[model samples]
Target: MRTRTTLAAAGLLLTLTACGGDTDDKPSAPPSLTEEQRASARAAAGLPPEPSTTARYRFLEALNDIDRRIVDGKDGKDDKAVSRGLNQCRSIKNAAGDEDKQVALVQQTLSRFTIDTRLPDIATPETGGEILAAVHKNLCPDF
Candidate 1:
């Protein structure tokens, strides 16, 4: 069982950390939303909340173990990669235990994580399904 206080604290830290780095003259991109907002949106969509900050880092570390591309460059602080992984969790939660749904989400999201890196693409549903399993275990376990 988890506590609301813990979740709120983690959300605060995530927002704080995610707020760092220069935004001045930063190229326009999708507007950023805080972790709490993201989580609320996920919940509104009928998905489960993401893990704590510690768990998220652990999740990234586990994915890094599976393939370098997942965390290539930026030394695991790659915001895009991390978001991509968390988005996987959202879809995976919605997927429930349906193997095909999970596999398809992997196909859609996994390639984006791997492409453009020096490493070969980790896009295959077979491999992606395995990697997404790590996301499930660390961040969004069965509920």
Candidate 2:
């Protein structure tokens, strides 16, 4: 469970850079996971990787960075971060399946991000538990 939670947090950091938006001179290459690492990730998430788990991991790292920026109160970073995170999040959601169980998994993950990071309240959520609850409420009210 702990491993899965950590992977979920990492997944949030998965970013647009993995989506071919790098501005560097050299094109970025996807990372290859070792058998142990891949098995750990699979066991953690209890789901096999899509065709692009490397991209997902990179995206999670990026999201983690953006989340730090948000915590630091960087100007105009929230919008960009949230937009990008939401995009990856939607991909995650779609991959997980559009069902109540899937929504619960996402809810677990959002809570894990806050708990694992010890993030201070910054928005209408007002508290970590509330943040998770509100995200669960707003993101998938039907569930």
Candidate 3:
């Protein structure tokens, strides 16, 4: 009788443990883009290399730089960094061909720029919208 009771309790405990544990059945998310991949994409697209340092490719580069900085956790104490970057990005509305390609690259980079671990939970949505608005203004200023 004692042996049977011990076996039944052990079986019940095993069943409970199995039911409470997580399953390995779900698929994991894809890996994120590497710095080299991002740089290559920007270079192949003829966009500015650092985005933030130069004013010749002003608009697009600024956007790319700002996005890169924010995503790379380099956004410093300057609040105007975002606005300044956006302003530069907004300045290239009339560019054509390679210039336009760079602008498009900026737009693409911004579109893919994710704030996942860098931003505060409450500020993420608003910041993203602001970035999107900046991109929109650059792409289509009149709207």
Candidate 4:
């Protein structure tokens, strides 16, 4: 009986740990990028040539990744599906109302598509751009 109880406790601990309770609440700073990398991402997103701050650069990088994945034909082209998820994500970010919170929300939102098995179809580049736009419309419409 003691052994069984010990095993049960161990299993419970393992399950809780696997639930990702250790996730950081703080968002990490975006990585620094070379001018070429920034330019490439900007070009991919059709932005004008100019210096981009960390937030803009990270957003562009995320957009570029989606665009690249779409061109590579890795996912389906269901814009509506992507739009729905992105809209929800955008709402979450808007409610957060701070740059760090928004960044955290975006990271969490995007990570769900990759990590959550039961999530709906992944977003393609076009869909990803649309999703970004949805969020940016509220957060940085001029960006």
Candidate that would win on lDDT: 1
The weakest ten consecutive residues by lDDT in model 4 span: 111-120
Sort by lDDT, top down from the best: 1, 4, 3, 2
Q: Write the per-residue lDDT of candidate 3 for residues 2-102, one digit (tens) a residue.
A: 99999999999999988875677676899888989887875555443443433323434444554545534355423344444444343333344465555
Candidate order by TM-score, highest to lowest?
A: 1, 2, 4, 3
TM-score versus the correct structure, for each prediction: 0.56, 0.28, 0.25, 0.27
Q: Name the regions of candidate 2 deviating beyond 4 angstroms.
A: 1-57, 69-98, 115-117, 120-143
Whose lDDT is higher: candidate 1's or candidate 3's?
1
| Stronger candidate by TM-score (3 vs 4) | 4
Q: Comparing candidate 2 with candidate 3, which one achieves the higher lDDT?
A: 3
Query: How much does candidate 2 score in TM-score?
Result: 0.28
| Highest TM-score scorer | 1
- Report every candidate's CA lDDT: 0.69, 0.45, 0.49, 0.49
Q: Which runs of model 1 end up more than 4 angstroms from their true locations? A: 1-39, 75-77, 115-118
Hey, what RMSD does candidate 4 come out at? Answer: 18.2
Candidate 4 residue spans exceeding 4 A from truth: 1-66, 70-76, 112-143
Candidate 1 C-alpha lDDT tens digits along 1-143: 37988999999999999988976866779989998899789888755675678877787778778775567657545666666666676777777788787557766555655643334455566666667777678767763
Candidate 2 lDDT over residue span 71-126, tens digit each = 34467654443433333344354545556655454444445454335444432223
Cα deviation of 87, candidate 3, in Å: 19
Q: What is the lDDT of residue 47 in candidate 2?
A: 35
Better of 2 and 4 by TM-score: 2
lDDT of 3 at 130: 55
